[model samples]
Target: MRNPISGAISTLAARPLVRSALTVVTALSAVLFADALLSAPPAAAQQGFGNFFSYQAPKPRRTAKKKRQVDPAATQRAEPGKAGEAKKAEKSGPTQPVSIIVSLGDQHASIYDANGFVTRTRVSSGQAGHRTPSGVFSIIGKSRWHRSNIYSGAPMPYMQRITWSGVALHAGVVPGYPASHGCIRLPAGFAPQLFGMTRMGARVVVSPSDVQPVEFSHPLLPTPKMQEVQVPQETATQTAQQASVELASADVSPDKTAATETKLLNPIAFASVLKKRAVAEKAAASAAEKAALQAAQTAGAEARQATTDLDKAEANLKAAEAKAADPAPVPSAKVQPASQAPTDTGATPSPEEVAAQAEVAQAKAALEQARATKAEKSAAAFAAVEAYKLAAARAEEAGNLIDEAERRSEQVSVLISRKEGRIFIRQAWKPVWEAPITIRDPERPIGTHIYSAVEPSADGSKMRWTAITMPAAKASTSSSRDRKKSKTAEASQAAVAPPETASGALDRIELPDDARQRISELLWTGGSLIVTDEPRSPEMSENATDFIVLTR
Candidate 1:
């Protein structure tokens, strides 16, 4: 204040010192702040932060406890019910003897009993015209009065018919094997003995070949047949009436019993004993009605299936017919030759024969061409169908993604605008600076700009700047140098690239010496370096080579 000039100089000098001191303080404060920031624990370091508050200790693994042993007597007493069940099973075990072996090949049969076994005589099978069908067939029905269509229409002696459709094992001439039309013909006078050995529901195994022979030590004693044990006709009829009454009363109600018994008995009598049983005709009519109903249902199903298949076939046939209708160009030589062929003949060929020959030739060629075209079209159709399937799958996937995106968009609360200025800024005085931006959610801070434009909104909510043009100044030069350097670096990196092998090339090819020498000789002799053979890996022989390499 005393001397203004001196005071100004002194203040100016002190200003520099004060500024230096302040700079040091700021630097130190910055260092200390950075240190503090770096040294502090992470924000997520709190104990029991991640699922720890509600955490439960793992349960201890349980060890299997050894089972306590019980006494045999205690176990037996504990399950008294099982003892009764075992005794019942023992009582019911295999009461009747089952058949042991049945040979379809050797035409022999055997039966087993609790005491021993019994063998039967050989039998002939179905002849060549009607071979016996080999299969595991069960005895579904039996008839004692079985007859044959072949063998002089003779009544099968001692017949025990097994199959329902007329095949049976009966007394007939056994000419070694498979001599009868289709019947399992047994040896003469042996059918009765075979029948005696078999039960009503016994299993009969017919194998493709005969098994090892089995000897029977114990033979069954024959039972005598009752010759004079007939009752009076009236008594017999009364007994049958009583039996039918008992059958009618048991389980089935009287009306249902009458219906069922009538149904069973009528089929046999309707065809054979119609005069004897007039009432049975009504039962046969009911069966006939049921059969008609079944046949109609089956026919309807078949017709529906046939219609569907016919529709598809007709479509294919139309396509083929259309292709066949298109005329193919014939060569001039082929036409001339065909015309000459008729002239060369001494007599003029008949129009029919000429037409027939042409038809045959045309048909053969058309058939071949059709087959080829069909194969190609089939392949193309298969590929097209697969492509369609793939496209459909992709479209479905994209649709699902779009649906998910739309659902997510519904949950977001944000206003979106599509106006030009909402994304870019434009200026009047300067060249246009075009920048485009996408706002995923308008609620969040705007992300990086995509492209710039020149117009700005009226309210200054959006700006339009001129197209950015770099000034031809020091900055431009520096950027160009940097780009050149980057290019050079890229070129250098590319120059040091590893050598690539050809797709099917090999090194140190293994080939037979003879093949190698032959190939060399051929090449030396000015022959084309072609070797025709199948290709093999690891080693190439003369027989394995398959290509030509030509050189000038």
Candidate 2:
């Protein structure tokens, strides 16, 4: 008979409860391991895990095999119209990135989606006095029923503002030539359609010169430090239903119905707290720069005055030395104090000689003091200059940041915090929503990652972005050959890797059911997702831009 004790042990080990417990423990370990991302080094962007990423490598195209040369007529007869039908059925990417270009010379505008060209149309530009400025710009504002305050309350239907000074693209009369007040006038129905499709923060390149984006590799793109600043959010005034109704019955003529409700969002609320903070930071930076410059000027003046004092002291010292060097009057030197007693043989010095000696000592002291003062002044001036430079640099950086923020004010962004182990969704500096997230492992090596949306599906339902994964704060690097070997090894190893381990891509993150539902609804182009090991700073209260602290 079999041993009953051994049979009991085997039965217990095979129990479903025991296996389920083991699975749970394994999952817990994975979460701990993922947390180590911040403490580990990352690989490069191209092969394995990298701090930066780019568009996914395109699928390799299949090459048609060659056959023996045959008569053209024979080939045509064999295939008939079959080849042309096959070509018609070919399809490509589900969606592509959206970019726009406007050319003044050609009086034309073109839009490009990810795969290739999309739309091209003629446009009317600015007139003589109100010439449209040509430069690269981003669409910062859009309105269905907008009226210009600069002009005599002229109605601008389907207006899209590109500049702060009221330059826009709108539906107006395109007289086949330049004839607008610094605006690009589009065709009637096309404007509303484009408006519906276009998202906030879309690039609008207006160029006097002929230019197009081309693919070129360079070291300058992004590696050691790379990031794109985004714009803050804006609030809408009208309810969704109201907007839908107004847009349906659109009119831009002066005689249009005044009863038509036009939307005007409150800028303060519409603009995200992040944008406000960015503006405040930029202003503070400017003030700091000004103060530093003033300080530097004052110190410089003090330094110059010290040098002048030094010169005077040196002159006085030189005069004293000359008088001391000269042979003293023989008679004066021989003279003795008249009060001296005849019995006293020792001679006393005259008052004139004593005064001269004292004078020399005084001059020497003055010279030393002046030298010391000059050194101090010089040091102060140098320090002031350095301080000014640092302040100015900070101010300039802040200014640049604000400009970026304003330009990107309508874009979407995602924030991931290792400290909270949660993810946040933002648009134009406004918080859309937030969700609790978990990493694969909390104890293993993990690093900060960023993913940016560069392409969108044709229906704008799905988004595809590039990833950037940086090593932890303190991570080591291996040899080039070792890194290459690691990449190859990683590919094979990744097949067996746990799902918790991230690739720094959009899919790397796990969202709760609620968050997932939101993503499906609000997906758009050119969005950014940032993952950091840092916590949300305590100082980031109302009117504070979160980007500032993240960059810091």
For candidate 2, write residues 114-173 as lDDT tens digits.
Answer: 443455556778865676665444566789999997998888899988765678899888
What's the TM-score of each model vs. the native? 0.21, 0.32
**Cα lDDT listed for each candidate:** 0.36, 0.55
Model 1 lDDT vs. the true structure? 0.36
- Relative to the unseen true structure, what is the C-alpha lDDT of residue 406 in candidate 2, on a scale of 0 to 100? 55
Worst 10 residues of 2 by lDDT: 220-229
Report residue 286 deviation for candidate 2 (angstroms). Answer: 1.9
> Which RMSD does model 2 reach against the true structure?
33.8
The top-ranked prediction according to lDDT is 2
Model 1, residue 50: distance off in Å is 99
Tens digit of lDDT per residue, candidate 1, span 15-131? 656467677566555544444433344432322122222333334569998896432232112123444432332244322333324454445554433322333345666654664
What local lDDT does model 2 show for residue 180?
Answer: 92
- List the candidate 2 regions with Cα displacement exceeding 4 Å: 1-271, 327-348, 410-552
